[model samples]
Target: MSTTLHIVLAAALISIGGCGDDTTPTDTGIADTGAADSSPTDTGPTDSGSGDTGDAMVPYVPDWSCLGSVTTGTPTAATADVTATFTDFGASGPAVGASIQYCPWDDIPCASPTDTGTTDSMGMVTLTVPTDPDPYWGFVVVELTETRRHEYYTSVPVVNDATPSALILNDAAINVIALVLAETQDYDANGVIGLGALDCAGRVASGMRIELTTGAGTAFYATEDGTFSTSLTETSTAGAWGVLNAVPGDFTATAFLGADSTPIGTINFRVKAGEVAGLFMFPTPDGAAYTP
Candidate 1:
């Protein structure tokens, strides 16, 4: 997604992916990626590093050979049932009457909608889709309008016969979308966080620490209690991991297995203010964000 947002996602209100001036990226990787500098603070987690990003990263190429694909949730028959629930972190409780839809996982922006529905009084909806289930993965994308005063957006990777217990806001995720300071109003009013870790099979990975070799001073990592911290403990997760207060710019990032210096995955992502750019982590040695 060199400049085009490898994991680029565009919204009517916010363009979640892509860089306006990012030059084309030639190659990507690292060997001696130094430790990122971080300071424990109440605002969020921070990781400092000694690299500077200039060239755009190459389009995301999944090295899926070595990294396997998750097989458990694959749909076997045509037209499967997917259960979706929407909840808010603050006082609203559930996202009632919220709009929900089914989109192929490969399309990050959820540009295409195959099936759609509206959440009920309980803040839940079940949508059935055709048998073709993205051929690889299926996702339930949620959009909030007037429900929270600000437009809200979020997606959860799901499968046939499975229902997401809580696609709840404030669920603590590593990726956050904020308004790029300008004339644009910040749309992320609910502080919705999206988890972006996937196992070799493209499933959400358990836990790890993501360090920016040349990025923001602090990041927001989601805790089980549904709060954010910049501490080492928050760098780890049984769910999703993320960071914030990152200046809108290009930077190199490395993922390590909790306190271990060995690099598991290396990625270059761009975070523009007012955009929901994502730096999804994939297993290394084969997949470069896209597992082999």
Candidate 2:
């Protein structure tokens, strides 16, 4: 008995032949010779119409979406529970362990974030907003990958339940810090008397009345309790005060003594979302003016 081993490079074929029991060779179309057969029909990988080039090209498509239940109030509560679920485009599994952030829609320099957290094992996060006020339009950001891919969800509206108002995009919250002294004196002799009345420690004004209205004099903060509740007269306690929500633009603030209806000082200023504007009210020898 004789055995022959044949190796061919052109068609990448190997064959074995022997004169034993007349077994048919597995390498089809190859003669029972041990020489390399480099034929025209046996072209290598680049052979035309050979159908062995490679896998077909598939274009890359992004996978992203926000999944979960999100709700907003007419006048959003001071605090509310918010839940978010992140998933890939197919919505099959969670985008696990991603970073998430909630930015107030009205925040100027929109890059500034209001709240931040990370996704859980199930690609979900529950948030308890600490400073949520009425008209809470903002953005929710998800960092999808380690390569810095980002997804931004915008125009989320939230408002206080009691004094419900529609959320306005690009608007801001204004905090008015009032310094009320018992006397009509400059309190401090600085020419800028408003900055001089800085006795917020012991002389913190508890019931100083304040009002914020549109440039057209339409009062927006008319509630008595003064905490975004429209039914209460908004007042100050210990100099920390605020107009919970307002459109981003020009507006006027009026200050009065505790429980006094008379407007002692008034100032007009522009407000921006997620920003603080400071003003000082002093009832002094001069009639009424707000400095700073």
Candidate 3:
């Protein structure tokens, strides 16, 4: 692959602004970027059609294969403090008295809680979970009667980090997500894909565009406020990106400036019809821009 690699598409161990206000979380250690360019960026999302790369408009074909995956929540611990916050999307507020549980990533309808807690006045609960050398894929299970459904499940990438785990609240803004639901809506188990572009330091990004490798007409984008856009001219922000009604399966996507075909890099991930997946976007390590 002679093309310079700029961005890294990783399974958001800490998906979509996963970490809350903590600015100094360690590097998450994303790697294999080829001489990342120190350029200015405005990250965006991908959807159904290809942007004009100024070429012959041949269908976009991803030149890169799947690379190794990166998991954060590092400096593994035997036990860690995992904090989960429950929010009320309709009212734009936090909840009180919500319940939570922990389960291994492979478990569904979790057999039982690995650890448990109840949200306090602030809707936050800290659970002590044992950690391992590798990050835990699925942990915190949130239970709240305020939403359309009584349960919300997520993978806490910050589970292994010494610091408190990232906030596992609902996407709250973006809709059509397989897993993200609002207080006013019914839970839909249909498939959808979303991305939260950010810097290695955990800052959200905007202005870049994401494209599906399949050209399957599944592209979609949204802003921080949760509105959706399918126009080729709109750029996706750290706010949101993905296929609203996606074709479920393993998929590949490339990141680039809005409407331009030059890729920052390619990301690989799987999306089942009924789960929420957030893809993390990173620019070169020099802080080219953000998700900084």
Candidate 4:
């Protein structure tokens, strides 16, 4: 079987497509990528403007009070112990330093007062009050200063009631002597004659007596304790004895047995030159040579 051959040839066709279309939109929110926006906005630190803000500091205030007591009879035969305490009002902790000043209530110049002291957690101070024959009154003032404020405390009126039994001779012109007499003797003795007797009897007399003398030959006499104290306004000389003007000279004080002038004993002493004089005397032994 014979078949007819037919050949058909088609040319290769090539078509070029355009670039792909871009549909995704570009970013407009970025500052550099777009124009600046005009909307108003809040920034910087947050501000609520409320009352419970910042730090609160406390203010300082001072309030003080004083307490005091007195103990009678101290250093002197009659003296008193004065104590005072200074405290702060509403103070929970210990107080700072404090000062206390005391003076005679009647004294205007403030003679001798105690010094200031610091409180030892407890505000307290004590001082000695001298007793005087004349009534004395005084006050205690305490002061304190802190970083915040100043405070002051004052005590009520204080008085010294003690009385001194021993006489104080401060005068330079006066000579002082103390004597304790024996039970057998009735009078207190002093002067040179009293001193001589004190060596024998051991005990003297206690008391004071005054007398006047002309410094003449007339011998001055003391009866009680064999003490003789006499003041001479002018100087004079009697026989072999010579007495200087206003010169206090002590002589052997002699006590007689009775009005008969029998010599009992002599107390020896020297007079102090001045306005005042003191002497002590003692009892003498029997049969002792009595020379007037």
Candidate 5:
């Protein structure tokens, strides 16, 4: 009976083993499936100088120091192309192979859809601007031949048709020289230097005047006083009388305080393009003009 019982139990165990499912275990580390991965690692290109890698950064160089402009001497119409002449101060002649981009003046980071061009032998480029009832324009020029980045700013007017070249009328060359003349008067006897109606040395003065004379002075904005006299204001709020567009040459500056009969000082100063010359006038002890 015992032997028979043992045989039956062994048979039941064998039957249970045969009924079990046979399947292989899976790996949890790396998935192995029939479908392909939709999101793979990206190995795409990036912009230059983005510092993607943890390496030492390269220094940047400037492409241009200064630039100029040229227009058709007319207001730019919406359908017309606005032309400009760009020259570099560092270069002796025209800037060859330079690129020009037209953007809105308020644009902080100039974006795409930019009208672009390369400078020809004359360093001139034409940009097509869209027509609008009201338009304010800005420009950027890049010298691709040089490794460094450089840009300049100037006004671009948009009109219905080509009128006259008025763009960059006030945007003179950065290196162009200028002159600043200051008048000082001491109202109180305290001897504290201040720009006032009276000379610090206690001299009574009447109407004050400043004159800058040069042949090229007329080319820029000159006063109606026969080019010898410039626009003048009596208030000391202006700080100084200015000759902003003085050409490179000898110039005579005269200042008078008190009455027209009284002259403050007449001094000669030489100016170079792209530089600034300063002149100061004070009353002499004998009521004459002196420059210090």
Candidate 6:
């Protein structure tokens, strides 16, 4: 009986040991879900150089405003007076001696125009329109200026369509066409001789007077229609010799046509001493004075 009991006890102990060996503990410690979340991962906020972590931002703004006359009008054809005034929005106005530019609209390239004038003491600029009439178009641009240092410009337009009238004079009053005196022939004994003639369009008044003043201070008057010749000679008279001896200067010849000695036409001539001079008259109307 004792031996049987020992065997059973030994068998029971062996069975327990086998069961423990079949079911061993895993030793996993903790489940591996992902990497550790150290330092909060920093995903919420980013470094944008300004340290501005907020999502909102401010916008940018511009500095200048356009100021000038933008009105349109019809300007006078002969003379269109336009003016502009510039005032400083800032503390001080433009520096003294600073220049301004003005331009018209029809001008090509519209970059620069011939009609530019300077500013006055009061920072005001004035420009005159072209003497001739221009066709109807958009605004005329006037550019006010500053140099490259600080470039500033303004534009103004003058609008109008009425053309100015031209000056008119009576045609009958314009009788004499031209007056001329030329160096035709020079003589060693006579010094210098010049022929004088009057160019008339219509009938010249009878008893008209023609006066010729030579460069050498020699002067003569003629009442006839054809031609008159005079010579510069050394004389004893004070004004006479002084004029004849001096070098030839500019000569101004005048013609009085009407009975009251009204000036019909006056012409200019360049005379040189010791040279023969010639003068021609064109009785045709609207004849131009020429030098040969």
Q: Which candidate gets the maximum TM-score versus the true structure?
A: 3
Tens digit per residue, CA lDDT, model 2, 2-95: 0110001101110000001111211111111111222212111111112222322121111111011112223324664456544432222455
| TM-score quality measure for candidate 2 | 0.27
Per-residue lDDT over 1-292 for candidate 4, one digit per residue giving the tens place of the 0 to 100 score: 1010000000000000000001110111100111122221110001001011122211111100000111111222245544433333224223446555555533333456543344455554555555444223343333455321121111111223211000111211011111111112111221111111111111111121112222111222222211222332110110001111223443333433232343333333233322212222222233131121
Give the per-residue lDDT of model 5 (tens digit) for 1-292.
2322222221111111111001110110011111122221110111011111123222222111111111112223445465645433334345567766756544534576257887788666676766543443443435445312333321123333221111111112211212212222111211101111112221112244555544133211111111111334431211123344445565555445423334444444444443333232322222322221
Superposition error at 101 for model 5 (Å): 0.6
Q: Give candidate 2 misplaced runs (Cα > 4 Å).
A: 1-73, 90-92, 106-111, 130-133, 146-148, 154-156, 160-292
> Where is model 3 poorest over a 10-residue stretch in terms of lDDT?
1-10
Candidate 6 lDDT at 174 equals: 9
Over 1-292, each residue of candidate 3 has an lDDT whose tens digit, in order, gives 1101001111111232233223232333222223222321212211111222122212222212111222333434666566555444334345577667766545655686677788888767776655565444443455556332222222123344322222232433334232332212222544445555443333444556666765342455543333444654434332346554555565666666554544443555455554544455544323222120
* Candidate 4 positional error at 253, Å: 59
Each prediction's number of clashing residue pairs: 31, 20, 19, 19, 23, 17
Go through the candidates in order and give each one's C-alpha lDDT.
Answer: 0.36, 0.29, 0.41, 0.22, 0.30, 0.24
Candidates arranged by lDDT, highest first? 3, 1, 5, 2, 6, 4
- Model 3: residue 135 alpha-carbon error in angstroms: 3.0
Sliding window of 10 residues with minimal summed lDDT for model 5: 20-29
Task: Identify the runs in model 1 with alpha carbons over 4 angstroms from their true place.
Answer: 1-74, 105-111, 130-139, 147-159, 167-193, 196-207, 211-218, 223-227, 231-240, 245-256, 259-292
Q: In what order do the candidates fall by TM-score, top score first? A: 3, 1, 5, 2, 4, 6
Better of 1 and 2 by lDDT: 1
